[model samples]
Target: MSTQNYLVISALGKDRPGIVDELSKAILNIGCNIADSRMTVLGGEFAILLMVEGNWNTLGKLEEAIPALEQQLDLTIIVKRTEARDSTARALPYVVDVVSLDHPGIVHQLANFFSQRKINIEDMATTSYAAPHTGTVMFSVHMTVGIPADLHIATLRDDFMEFCDTINLDAIIEPAQR
Candidate 1:
């Protein structure tokens, strides 16, 4: 009997046509199964987030192959090992969406707040664009968040309210399940 290990990898670099193929093939050759993934273009960069499961014997093989692929494709690869699932119960995940005028600090501000509250952001997508004479680009972000049951939901809501006020941005935070 054997237990499998999961590795999470994030890939990012300048956007190009075949980056996905290169990474996908590399994963296949290493005998790992990509359990989940999201690949998209953001701010002229192609980024991929993948969760893959493989045996220990092949883990190093996969890790070693990444640098070669990186050099050939001019990209950066980040990989980390995931811990075994916790046996205890976990809290339900939540959703937090924010949209505002694009500014230098929008991401930084939100990230700082999320970190402070121990909110695990499972996934996030952000985009921005400028309108004629608008002077500032509009930015939109959707985040899938997880909140531990012990945390006060009201506190999270209050934090968002305060953050919104300080940034002059509109935000909505509510029970993810109604």
Candidate 2:
């Protein structure tokens, strides 16, 4: 593995089809390899987040390309070099995926559960889906959590399961390797 630096880029604006095509083309034109990315429509708006890797000195290439990209797409772009990617890598991270029928208080219920247990949430994405015409709704959440090695996984899972049953939700926990 290369220990070279990279950049984390993110952007958000009104939802429009083909935003991905435009952004990807821009990054490629500047000669950066995208290492990882997530682009989705969130609340009537399109949002894009990406990790780009290239020689550390080529950052100027990105800066120059962003302004024209923003003007062409009418979207805001934020980019930051990942010079300290491992600064917080001392602890292992675990991912918890939760899915349940749409209902009030689902997010708060699950988020509060983690808060009370002192779990660190690294990243989370929650979205609600509506069944066409029928109007039925469902909610799904994918969250990456950081659990210290000393934490007991089984006990934590059992505790969550107890309430998951009453809420009609399913939860799964898995370790994410560095």
Candidate 3:
């Protein structure tokens, strides 16, 4: 039986076409599988995060080839081995949406509030754009948070709404469908 080894790979470089193709070809050549990944363009840079799976020999081959790829692509690459963890099936998932006039401190304050309450943010994305007609800069955030089973959902919702009100943000909280 082949022993499964997991590798977490992260890379960042100037945004350009063919980066994914090149990296993917390299990974495939080494016989590793791209199990999960997230890639996005942030400003002028392309950020890549991937979880790859293979046996020891394939993983070693990929490791040896990484330096040449990094040099060729002008990328900063980091690779790490990670142990798998059990999924949090017991945690309740909630979608939190917030929108307000663009300003600093909104994200920090929101993160702080959740952190203080021991909430876990699973995924979050934020964007800024000009509002229609008014042309005022507006910020919007969508996040998936994990609420522990012991927490009271109604109480949490009430407190979150009140906090948003105090900060002049329009917000909504609802269950995230699986």
Query: Residue pairs in steric clash, candidate 3?
Result: none
Expressed as tens digits, the lDDT of each residue in 69-167 for candidate 2 is 899998999988776455555555888888877988988998898888888787898988886788688788988987666778889878878878888
Ranking by lDDT: 3, 1, 2
- Over 4 Å off, model 3: 1-3
**Native-vs-model 1 lDDT?**
0.83
**Model 1, span 30-137: residue lDDT tens:** 898888899988779998898888898787788878889889878888999895567574765778788888778887888888888877776788888785696577
Report, for every candidate in turn, its global Cα lDDT versus the true structure.
0.83, 0.81, 0.92
lDDT of 3 by residue, 1-178 (tens): 7678888999999999999999998899899999989899999999999989999889888888889989988999999987454585578899999999999999998999899999989888899999999999999999999988899999999999999999999999999998
Candidates sorted by TM-score, best first: 3, 1, 2
**Per-candidate TM vs. native?**
0.77, 0.75, 0.91
lDDT of 2 at 39: 82
TM-score of 3: 0.91
**Better by TM-score, candidate 2 or 1:** 1
Better of 2 and 3 by TM-score: 3
The list of candidate 1 runs beyond 4 A from truth reads 71-74, 85-89, 131-136
- Distance (Å) between predicted and true CA of 3, model 1? 1.0
